[model samples]
Target: MTESQDLDLTPRDADDVSVGRKRLRNWLIMGTFTAVIGFVLFQALTSAAQFYYNVDEAVARRGELEDSTFRIQGTVTSEQAPDANGALIFTIAYGGVDTAVRHVGAEPSDLFEIGIPVVSEGHWEGDVFQSRQLLVKHSESYEAENPDRVEYDLDDTPGYVPDNTVE
Candidate 1:
């Protein structure tokens, strides 16, 4: 009787094998789906990251930057008058190297004059950096205007106002 009881316990039914296979298949499906989702997320986040380079570095790495978005920091070395289509072409230089830039959107800010530092974000095309966005960096110093030096025109109607109030 003990032997008979042992045999009954040792033998597994077909139902048990079927249940085990189903559980393993379900777990494999879940794991595969999770891995695929994680891979896609990683790819998207890495592609969206933008790296910045100086003018000299950009010129040196022009081959790698082609068709890729990047940020460049430099000074406006030269500028050409706007074309009939309002496209502004200019050159920015840093570390003694220059990169040609073309902007087709709105004109640069008043502070975007020559020799001023600028950070441009765009992609590198053939022999040029096509920038869609331009940022001008200015000094952080602030100076208040003198209130004592007020100018009034005698020959014209006087409606002038000073910037600061004198104590």
Candidate 2:
């Protein structure tokens, strides 16, 4: 036979081609799935992470922080009644430095008051810190020891009388 006739020019078996195609397809699917999962985890972690700082440290780094969201811990040195828009304005102090905060959200619990420590979460706007959430810090032991102590203002509660008061 001639050399040209002896050469096997016909295509390879169907099974060989199909096996290569299936392997490539599986790899593509796995790669896409891994990429998607990685992206989702990155987003969740970044959004959940919150940097914490004291009032004095936050004030010192105000220029660097700018509009970034964070948490500040300090004692509530002063507080104002709800404003016209129902925002509670207060001042928190730490290490002898004070930062003003404008809280616009649900009213804080009875534990929130002047002289109490708190952690405010939000970003700084101009010279004041605009907060959406407030966390009050109180000792459970203190409450247990002073069960009779009135922590909240009585005048604010309309028609509510204290049973422990002397008639």
Candidate 3:
């Protein structure tokens, strides 16, 4: 074909060009959609930080834990005598571990006794934890005489007869 008398790159039918353009547009649109979807999915899977903290986690992350109010789950470690009428004192036991906590408030509930698991919420003060609230877990063991299992007079007042009596 002679130079100017010759080739037309454009398709003879406008419809063909339009169809090709439509296909290109569709490809572009699909690419944008795919990118957006992938980004949202990635964010969903890898966003927030999680922690199942224990005594060790707290002790290990002591600096971070000092001012931040978080969770501490432990058992009553050793005997803690509540001040004549002041705070409830005990230690939490968890993860083969324990942490001392002193809770000051009204008289503790019946469940607040030795050897019972407790969940306390509060801030750690120096070496000891000063709990704002105390929650006690029930005992798993059974006693035949005391089926009710409501048995403990920690104060051991003169008139108090413990439900669990010695034979």
Candidate 4:
């Protein structure tokens, strides 16, 4: 029988060991980068999700939502004319709860009337919801109410002034 020679398969020099360690380190770094990128993507997607709260729900969760920006949808009950500073103060109610809101920067839409549904976006400050944007929502199919006008003669008035006078 001929003599058998054994060949070692393991790393024989420091360079071989270093190369192996370098490959391991690269893999670890790439895995870490992938994990970080995935985590950031998840956070970005979740952070962009917006939520809307009703008046009653908002009032109930005021403490928790005080610092968060959200939308509140409700029916306008009463509103006051803009103050000297052009800030409109209105009250909206839903589910038997009323929420006071203060809107600045712009006037409410013409369709924003009492008893109409509106959505306000802002955060709560103390007990009031401060908003810079207000959306008035109307049904897709809307019909205007037409009422008959009463015919009245100006001569019936005790004292009447005419815009145009002819000799």
What is candidate 1's lDDT per residue for 102-134, written digit by digit as tens? 887666789887666787888888878898888
Evaluated against the true structure, the overall lDDT of model 2 is 0.77
Tens digit of lDDT per residue, candidate 4, span 45-154?
A: 87546546788899899999967888888777777878788898888777667767899867778998766778888899998899878998675765556577554353
RMSD of 4: 14.5
Per-residue CA lDDT of candidate 2, range 1-167, in tens?
A: 69777897656665777879988999999999999999998887876565468888999999999998899887776678788999999887776677789999877789897677788889999889999999987755443557687765543322222332111
The TM-scores of all predictions, comma-separated, are: 0.54, 0.58, 0.49, 0.58
RMSD of each: 13.4, 11.0, 12.5, 14.5
Better of 1 and 2 by TM-score: 2
Candidates' C-alpha lDDT: 0.72, 0.77, 0.63, 0.75
Overall local distance difference test of candidate 3: 0.63
Q: State the lDDT of candidate 3 residue by residue for 29-140, as single tens digits.
A: 9999999999998876654233225665665676778866655665554555567867776665555545677787555578666556665666778867777777665657
Highest lDDT against the true fold, candidate: 2
Model 3 residue 14 distance off true place after TM-score fit, in angstroms: 55
Clashing pairs in 3: 74-93, 75-92, 75-93, 87-104, 88-103
lDDT for 66 in candidate 1 is 75
Model 2 regions lying over 4 Å from their true place: 1-51, 143-167
